[model samples]
Target: MTPPASLKLASHEGRAAEAAPGPEAALAIRGLTVSYGQTPAVFSADATFPARTMSAIVGPNGAGKSTLLKAALGVIPRVSGEVTAFGRPVAEARERIAYVPQRASVDWDFPATAGDVVLMGLYRRMGLLGRVTGAHRRTVRACLGRVGMADFEGRQIGELSGGQQQRVFLARALAQGADLYLLDEPFAGVDAATERAIIDVLKALRDEGRAVVAVHHDLSTVTRYFEHVLMLNVRPVAEGPVETAFTAEALDATYGGRLAATHMDSLILATA
Candidate 1:
């Protein structure tokens, strides 16, 4: 089958390949490989998420979806490969990127209010010994309000419901004033209302000329929520506009025959 026009297929030679990200690329990864004690998690991955677009990274369980994000962000070590944000090294462009980890990975038991957690996003501006001025508190309040958590600002994180907690974390990311947003399962375990709210915010960011990339699990919502897609297993299967790259052939390559025929048909029909 012919690949999508913009999709970047893994090199047949089993070597790391570069992406033709062009000039507008907001985040680019080439030949990224990661391992945990000799067990490979990701291999020769290549992807490019461009500015002003919203993209989704989709794959089956244990597909190293989250590992890819961590490696690109320099939060975890990669065995090989390079990652750049806005055509610069991730370290040099750190402030331009914001990452929201899987909600399940966070410690909700921490003794902090919803507002306090959001305030952490501004820590870079506040400095280690700096005191939070009234302006900072207002900024925090504004971020919470943007995610519909304004009324819950004083509530402890652990006391909130799953959806509320997710919204609070998103508000925290919003406070970062970032040009690129990386979210890991932002819609996982959330109510329908929360999912709608979150997607709206992400779309708004895209409209504002920022980039949003998420390690997403729900294939059913991928076409509705995103403009571009990166289908991945350990390596990239396809990467490009959703309408072109999100085909059954690409999905099969990424899943390695794990998806049942009936489920795949239904998903195609739903997205179509």
Candidate 2:
């Protein structure tokens, strides 16, 4: 499938092109292998993510999808290999990348307001002993507004609905002003409206030449929401454009026999 017109233009201009292998990828994982104790979680995974595209990491349960995202963000201990961002080591590029973990992974009762959570993103920019200035507040407000959470600024995080909470976290990621976004399950357990809103926000980010990688399920939405897809089952099953990687055969290989059979039937009907 062809990339969107905006991505094509960016490629022609040599600025934030989705397909031009941006500066050796906004994020690169090479020979990356991870293990927990004696059991290996990911094995010899290698991938490059160019800028100005939305990439989805899709796989069945226990496929190490979340583990891959965490390892890329340096949140998990790797047993081997390397992860680099913008041609720099992970540590050096930390400030340039933002991570939004799974909603189920966070404690909603952490006693922070939505604005407070958003402000956490500014910590990297503000040194120790630096107070949040009016400028920072304005930035947070703007980011909240962008995610349609302006009125929720003062609301406690635990009080929010599942979708609202997800939006709040996305606003926090926006506040970081990062060039790369690593999001895990941003669409799980949300209302349909919230899902659409998140997709729109991600598309906008891609248009602005930022790279966003999401650990996503829901095969039905994969092709519609992402241009690139990484299919995995504890290893790299496939990685490329959604239309290329999200095929029945690839899905069958990643999801095992039963689900793959079901998905193939669905794919046939969709095409027919």
Candidate 3:
């Protein structure tokens, strides 16, 4: 389903966030760089994800898509650059942001129930030593219900299917009560039904005027699920509306000499 053509980006850049144009952006990163020892994962790149839009960070493997998220969230130390949320420093705005890492990165065997995982999202708001009050638990339960996992709260996450586990994580993010959601490939391995459900939830978030930025690999579905796109390959290739930024030219630059047809072929075989 294509979005209404009325969506715009100027309001996003009208703030004092950066000279880059967008103001009051849900997330704004400038000159972001990350490296490990002598290896540079990402060079200077800038992108401002506007509120009320879903932006897909698209690129080939090793384009530093995941690194950008990690660096911005401070999960990993950055080499240099700045990341802000709602025009505030990243740390100062932490409480208002929720991140759902790739499902593969978790330890499924960890002895934790679905509810336990969802409640974890509240750690920042609750303070490191804060207790989980009954009200907080109720909120967790309600979040699970919103994601269609109310009945599975007590189930072990390790025992759930991939799709179910993803839903549980989505529920956890909802419990964060955030204004921005950063998801790393939420649709990578989900079933068709699960994919549809996730997209619906994402669109619902956008409807409520939240920003959703995801690291996505599916060229075919990028346009279908995202309203805006930030094409990346170590550095930014393009950043704008999905229709405008996802052109053959930009995609070519993002993939770095990799043709769009080749990527389409790979995607077809991969999903097959």
Clashes of each: 0, 0, 7
Each prediction's TM-score against the native? 0.91, 0.89, 0.87
Better of 1 and 3 by TM-score: 1
Candidate 3 lDDT score relative to the true structure: 0.84
The whole-model lDDT of each prediction reads 0.86, 0.84, 0.84
- lDDT at 89, model 1: 94
Writing each residue's lDDT as its tens digit, candidate 2 over 149-186 gives 99999999999999999999999999999999999999
Candidate 1 lDDT over 1-272, as tens digits, reads 43332244223212223333223678888889999987889998888887778989999998999999999998899999888887789999989998898899988999999999999988877989899999889999999998899999999999999999999989999989899999989999999999999999999998887899999999888888988899989878888888888888988898998988787887777667
| lDDT string, candidate 3, 128-227, tens digits | 8898899999998999988888899999999999999999999999989899999999987888888888888989998887889999987888777887
Clashes by residue pair, model 3: 12-22, 12-23, 13-21, 13-22, 13-23, 14-23, 15-23
Model 1 misplaced regions, further than 4 Å: 1-23
TM-score of 2: 0.89
Worst 10 residues of 3 by lDDT: 1-10
True lDDT of residue 235, candidate 2? 86
